[model samples]
Target: MSSSSPHLWSPVRWAENGSVRLAFDQLTEQRDGEPLLLATGLGVNRLWVPDGLCRMLAAQGFAVARYDQRDGGESTHLPPTTTRNPITALFAKRGEAYTAEDMADDAAAVMDALEWHSAHLLGISLGGAVAQRVALRHPDRVRTLTSMAAVPGDATGLRTMRYIRLRTLAKFARLKFPDTPEGAVAAGIAASRLLASPNRPLDEQAVREAAERNVDSGVHDQQAQSRQIGAQWHGPPISAIARPTLVLHGEDDPLIKPGAGKAIASRVRGARLVLLPGVGHELPERAWHAVTTEIREHATSAHHPPAPPAR
Candidate 1:
């Protein structure tokens, strides 16, 4: 693949529970390898991951797949829930009618479409939260679980973080997505700058391209973002997940802090935790190798059990 060109992903759609549809792309380089399904972050699409990283995972003997969540990319559009405004919803955490469990069903539907009976599920941020629900609600179908930069249910840690509040205020203070193409790119660039690792330089072009592709794909509206935010689950605690679980996070994450990751790892029985000291909310290129290594090792260990202890 050329560095100047992005991977051409042809997204096909799958409907779930008669209400939601998701757009997904898959690479089957390792046709029978453990199917690894990725759920992206909130208000974000699969394009958020660099195409190179996706290809790298595919090359490493894994059938890699990623999909847009319900409200982002070319997937289904859910109307704005008007019971509360965005500010109050963010602060008060109200008005969301759906939970990540619903989103996980969409994931199961996608897997059904692909005829994959079970998969190694991995997610980032909000995607990570959804992945947790998938494990909880459909434990038999999840081979292994990897959650990155995600908080547990209710996002209690995030709501308590001062930086999150400040960041929210700053973004809404001057938020605007211009109607033109250039404006869209600009909007993406700004968000990338804000979300990128504080320890690393920004990848402006990648962000710009992702934004442009998302715009071309379909509408990425504020309502969808708000709805997803409102979709935070208030159900059972995270301690009940029985899958081989890995929790990874950036210690410097401003959006969902390292504390959130730690909280999750503590709750899930035998869940492994990895914290990158110099990383942030968004996965930097530098952290991809670490992230992939954790995932590979976790899944491989799960599949290849240790020898018997008897002598």
Candidate 2:
């Protein structure tokens, strides 16, 4: 899938449910020796997963599809933004909240729009949270699960105060500076600086390029992003996920600590956790091979069935 190609391989339109519209781009080649469905992390349009990751996955023989979560990209953004504080909107009390389960439904709706009965699931960061809920809610719809730089909802991990404060600041920044290019650049830089492990510095040029791509792709919707974040923050339990799962985390990840991955793996039955030393929150080209390898292996093992008895 070239950058020049459309954001979605197919036209952007509403699903039968009428609440969510999906836009997706499909890879030209199939890797992992079969077709696979790919979803991007939160606050990202389709361009977040660079060509390197797409090409690598394609080489593995899995057809990759990347789409914008509702309210993030070209997909439909929720309407009638209230004058409520962004923080309050996200952490709504009780009945007023939208959970990760809703986002999972949106994902499944995307798969159904593409007419796929099931897909190999991959999600990064917030997308990982959404994917976790999807597998738990619709286990039969997932062939395998790959969660990269993500944490489960168990809350046993080392939730660093620095990371939490940074996230809160980032949200406020986005709400205040949703339009300025310089604001976008500053936000990305701040993110890189805060989330980057001191041991593994992200490439400055690469971060700049990614920021530019995000800026060029489209405007950020503060309300929608806030709502999604709130839903995940108040998400339900993850004990229901039964699919074969592989949890990947960067040891130096400052945003969601590696401990979160370990906790997630412990709670989910038979889940495998892989900690990548010296890596951070973002999935750069250096980490693509390892990430794709784990995904391919897990997805393959997930689909393989028991052998028949010798007659």
Candidate 3:
């Protein structure tokens, strides 16, 4: 594949796990960089992880790689079912597709493809929830964990609802965009606007080109989103996430409240929580420095333990 502006991604690669094929790509070369895998929100492709953010992480000695989860982007799309409403499927008694454990394995499969024995994990929104499950299910595969704008993996149904803002949830139903490529960009911007911090002006240009390239992202496909969210997590709870964990949430997040981050930080022993003032579900340019710095410091601390106290 050819290179593009803002997003300096390498050639797209395919990683397969049984019937599912995941699409992934790496940032610029960093031979000695630490392995960092990023995961995005519901029904989003790897492109959802902002190019600037990935570049900054890469510049900070992290070999970054992002992939599309099953049923999103260029990855495998499972068969549709009667489940259409994401909210209903979220609290359903049984999964209509696969278990959350399967999604966790999907992340591992990508790591295997990249030849990484283990890597640091960063996830946002629904991706953050998946990352938590990944940490719980494959503890040995995760070195450090960062979950942003997400609820606890173990929380389901009413428990999960406690952290969600219903007013913002209702807004998703009202968003309508055209069926063209331009429409895709518009929809992406609209969603970002909904999740962006009101304190900062929404920069549509920041994500327009990337969204254009990732037009195939099934963001509007509620059926696929239902299957993804409906997949139940029967694995260990967040308490079992023993990796060095960092929980971050936007103080002004319109969709998932900051309490979700608090829940994760509280349940995971020694987890550090950072609440970003005027930040929201979407990572705005203003937050780039703070977010990357926190991750860099957290990862560094994880790898290099504090010197033993001198007597």
Candidate 4:
């Protein structure tokens, strides 16, 4: 229950319909007597949330937990690469692929495994997609929902061709480089360069530190990340969500454009959208206060007590 550092709560092996055993890294901490579950984005392990966010949320008296998605971090990898096109893999055909619904089911399964009937859900990027699906499909399992830097399955709201080309290039670079230290360094630089705001002073040490942490977290299967992305891209629409939702996006996001967030807000009735200027794709320290504040406020507001008799 301590907030000083991440504590290994337990390991969960969730069996899906196909008997696929998905592994997850579950970190739990108590805050304000409520439990908060964080589902991370693609290509990242449980460490996707920065330490500052962990401490801040824990300080707010909510128990926080984060897990690695299937095919990423320490979870089970799919198989050796066969497809050369990342975009094609992301938009896979029917029965032969996984979808965001599967990922959302995985999250719900994790919560059920932990015996939590409901928990606040927070997701970033691809993780946000899963969270949305979860809230939509299993509204009773989510007390509150927050999607950061995410889209609502609207391909038109994505970045321009130039940015897509840049991301494709980065994907190729990652495929070529894999998990080498040099590749990690290069990937970190590329991510920072692509996601950082020009007005804000860049912190080289922090970037390097983040890179090191990503590397040291252990090797990830590139194929799994690819598959997860593919599934999310072809997942269900976001119009089914009924949970009180909050969508946070940077006004200057270079990767997933702000239009995506706006689209999501428009689809989900009563979903609040908070757009911060000068922020980028990655969750920088400067935007931490606002991001966490909004999440806490939204979640707290949604946690309503039983209504008294009509008067």
Candidate 5:
């Protein structure tokens, strides 16, 4: 497969899910590869998923599509509410915007728009939690589940705090950037650097390019991040996910602890867990091969199960 141009993606498509409209785009044109839908984290848009990573997956025979969640990217941004900070929102008693179910439905809406009846789900950070919820609410629509750098879907309020690093959160809360487009790019680069593994060098050029692609990267939109973090899940927990599941966590992740991956793997029956060393919250180029390989193998195994031994 040839390397795909970062700017040469399918035109942005709209998926209408109830009151919200989601923005998404197809990164690959492979009809034979398994359909893979990516859900990004927090306030970041679909561009946050590195183009190189998507290209690598496409080369591995996966048709990839990524989308912006309700309050992020080009998606419908709801009227601003009282929630102003992600930390406060995490502890809020109730969601001031939408429920977690609505967010999961957004993923299904994207899949519907792509004409895919079912697809492998790959989500990172907040996206990871959303993916877990999608599998629980719409099991038939998810062929397999992959959650990376994410907490458990059902964990909420104080319970969710156990897997987070408060110091890292503090640092994120301290991040301040101007509201201009240039500031948005700076904020994105800074945030990416913060999430990058300390042991490896981050490719600032890739981050700058991605940020430049979306001037309104949403990294500074604390309100939207708050609403996303505050959205509560009332549906079944990760324990109820019946689809083949894979949990990946960075051992050196500064934002979310590796235990989050363990929790998801432990709850989901027969789920596989892979902890990557020298990896932080972000998917650097160094870790792309491992991540793609794992996802490819996971999807293939789910499709071709081992033959049962003769009795």
Candidate 6:
């Protein structure tokens, strides 16, 4: 096992109920520093994220933690009633339900379990939406926020004409992922080619290994994916959020257009928006260096804001 892997952070029970048990993994030596929670995107296996990225974030000097959101890979899966038909429960006032709010609570519950009064919040795609909700719902617990490649909410509509290239879609559709880890690794390589940056050649072997590791942890649940989409669909508007925020999005994201990012940055007062040219929905390996640098600077500067100008 690698020294900086979230595996070494060890799993701690984050929350539980009659249905599921959620947990978070630590990726650094100190849990007491400004805690940075890394929430994965929709339908993404928590382990699917490259270990090197997590390690680099931890090594950047924040106490890093990551976790499987409820019903995602390696997290407790819910019953068919909820996971399969999440839309029905969107407005239902009930316990043990999974909405975007509930998902944000799951992240906050992890924070609560850690006894962290507040921490840096960062997320990807759908997780980026979750980060916004976290700052909205549990504002006290979020010291700073970094939302990447996600829309604010339904308030900002995606353009009607946006669509992925058919060749790219065909490549993904043709990918036949096997049940075994080896085949999953191959599948990852295929998907990487489909979603990778147009500016660089895909790293076939590294993505394959990352895919295999994620497969070893667990397969992504289609039903859970249903719940995650429902949550994003019914999520609250975030225009009024007052947290110090960094909004990063690919200039050419076809799934959720760059306008969504612009809308979000416009909504959140003082949000810094960084447009990655020649990028897309996927956070390719090449983007990590710039992505992480912005996050590190954003979080660190939150601690040392400039003095008030002469009054």
Highest-scoring model, TM-score: 5
Angstrom error of the Cα, residue 303, model 3: value is: 1.5
Question: Per-residue CA lDDT of candidate 3, range 144-187, in tens?
Answer: 99999999988887788899998888888676667677776777
Colliding pairs, model 6: none
lDDT of 4 by residue, 1-311 (tens): 00123254444545343444555444455633576778776666666567677667776766776766776655655654554344555444531346666777888777775668899988887788778888877889999889987766323223222223355336444544557776765565555666666567778877776676565222233455657666633444677678899999888776777887888899888899999888977777778788888988898778773477999
* Model 5 Cα lDDT, one tens digit per residue, 1-311: 01236465788889999889999989745746889999998998777777788888998899999899999989999888898999999999989899999999999999999999999999999999999999999999999999999999999999999999999899999998888888988888788788888787777787677667667648889988998998999998789999999999999999999999999999999999999999999887778999999999999999898799999
Q: Report the C-alpha displacement of residue 231, candidate 5, in angstroms.
A: 0.7
lDDT of the structure predicted as candidate 1: 0.72
How many pairs of residues collide in each model? 0, 11, 0, 6, 0, 0
Give candidate 3's error at residue 92 in angstroms: 0.8
**Model 1 lDDT at residue 92:** 46
Question: Could you tell me which 10 consecutive residues in candidate 5 have the lowest summed lDDT?
Answer: 1-10
Candidate 1, residues 1-311, lDDT tens digits: the string is 01113334434656465677788877645656678898888676676766667666766667887888888776887866773334455654544567656787888887887788999998887789889988988888899999988877545434534325366445743667666767656666666666666767666676666666654322224567767766656556678888999999888776676777888899899899999877877767677788888888898889886778998
- Report the C-alpha lDDT of model 6 over 1-311, residue by residue, as the tens digit: 01235345676556553356666777646555568888877655566556667666777777877777887766787666543432332333442345567788888887776667788988887788888888988888899999887877443223212322435534544455566666655655555555666666556666665565555322323345556655543445677677899999987664557776888898888899999887877776667788889988998778887688998
Candidate 2 CA-lDDT value: 0.66
C-alpha TM-scores of all predictions: 0.86, 0.81, 0.93, 0.82, 0.95, 0.80
lDDT of 5: 0.89
**Maximum-lDDT candidate:** 5
> By TM-score, is 1 or 4 better?
1
lDDT of each: 0.72, 0.66, 0.85, 0.67, 0.89, 0.67
Clashing pairs for predicted structure model 3, backbone only: none
* Candidate 6 ranges with C-alpha deviation above 4 Å: 1-7, 17-19, 81-97, 154-187, 216-220, 232-236, 252-254, 307-311
Model 2 lDDT tens row, 10-98? 45444433566767656655523465666666566766667778778877768777777776677776653452344454344431335
